[model samples]
Target: MKKVALIASVAMVFSLSLNAWTLGKLGDFKFEKVNDNVYVMHGPVMMPNKENGGFMNNPALIESKNGLIVIDPGGNYNVGKNVLAEVEKVSKKPVIAIFNTHKHGDHWFANKNFQEKYPNVKIYALAYMIEQAKDNAAETWYGILGSLTGNLEGTKPFAFPNSSVDHKETVVVDGQTFIMRHPAAGHTDTDILIEHVNSKTLFLGDNLMKNRFGAFDESSSIFGNIQILENVIAKKDGYKDYKLYVPGHGPSGKLHETLDPFLNYMKIIIAGAQKAYKNGMESYEIKEEVYNNLKDYHKWDDIEGQMGKHLMKAYSEVEMRDF
Candidate 1:
């Protein structure tokens, strides 16, 4: 992706001041600068709900020559609006694009809100995510989260990402090269990875968490997820000297150090679940067994809700030989 000289003109016109940033809070989270032009709003480990103000997933903002490019805006209107509020403080330029890493609500439904704010902006996603967003896959989440969030009135239904790209597709937006990758079937069947070539940053949408593993639905695969993480860790030669490894949740950090915890957590979870199955224990019983064995890791982040569900899923993932 060759950079256009005009893009530099566009960047120069906007005198964006980083010194006067909104350092207080965007709802309950803060917009943190992880790299030279990349800003990330790191959300809490808790699930998406009214209590957390719908700030459950990390939304990253990339400043480019043309305009801002938002990654995984969020699950609802409020979170997206909050992200936009922060964007307004940082850059006066309009948003040129929005990329959703997957079909998960906490990852992408905010497309609608972003559209209303920046009507001409393009929303990009994997073809699978676009298909899921149009069909019952997204509809089911509308119902699930509606109830989970106690029918949050302003939260809208899924707005499908219009521009769909295939695997290994390279997109040049605002003078930045974004290389997208699909790592088997992990996180979800439609998990899409975005590699910002300029920053050497990888925005892993739920494929790998930083300090803690979070709860997931039936579409997730522990085995496939392990493969994704292993590939990322091994490919440091390609993704050399990582400035930031952004996960869907948790604080961003160096790729290897950030990914090590999730890898170790999965190893212990899968092994303990397999042991529980051998002991003739049910999923519910296995949860207690696995939790007892891996109790130390429960302190990672939001384990009160994520640990039990992860153990159950790990047991099923192993039982079905889907690893």
Candidate 2:
């Protein structure tokens, strides 16, 4: 009898411990304080799927005298709500402005949750991004995420950006100045480059990544990305001292540390693809060759999973070019 009772007690304790751990892990919101009033939640490096609860993207919060401004809030409704829960832990200011860095679903779908709570907050994005999210983009992803999470609770309908900015503009909110620049075709057709003037922090959205690169965006323009990257480099030169860069993924870094390596990687992709095409290689042959050759760039980040996909896309992109 005592042996059975001991086993039962152990089982009960273990069950309670597991439940506590699950709740604490899910409810926790980890954020990094980059500069004064600038807090960034560098989400899990894993992609948004069943395991991570559709959490990806470096969602940031900027507390200004006017209110809290959230950048790339996240990819799902719960993702944004959890961020808000964290915001409450730090500042009591209401979120006044929400900005979507680019058109990628990872950066914008969470707007629904924010809008439901703060309907008055001005959500900003490129006109195209806003329109798509309100229409097909978010709807398509919502279904995928639903299937992935089994229609997980807190996943809400898609929301639209209330304010669409077509031109470069500056807004002073709560005495803090923010400059928005359009990096057309850089990472995507709908990309925004935001300069948090007060903190000298540049939010590059998906335009720049650090430590490693994510999937190659087939929807974006390689040449256009190069042009915008060059422009961004020049802009970096104008800065008096080192400035912090909040990339869409990975860690925040300085321009030289983050942007320069990415520029080199982009150039290499173009050059490698063109060279493979000139070799009279068929598409299949080019993909195999490029996949193996690009493994050298693992120094930049793990390209094992993406190299095969990127090679196929790069080959087609270069094949279409006039050269």
Prediction RMSDs, each to the true structure: 7.0, 7.4
Off by over 4 Å in 2: 1-29, 147-152, 216-218, 236-242, 295-302
Q: lDDT of each prediction vs. the true structure?
A: 0.77, 0.72
Clashing pairs in 1: none
* Tens digit per residue, CA lDDT, model 1, 171-206: 999799998888668888888888999988999889
- The deviation in Å at residue 224 for candidate 1 is 0.5
lDDT by residue (tens digit), candidate 2, 207-310? 87765666656567776777766777776423223368888887787778777766777777677778878887755666655556555466654576665665
| TM-score list, all predictions | 0.85, 0.82
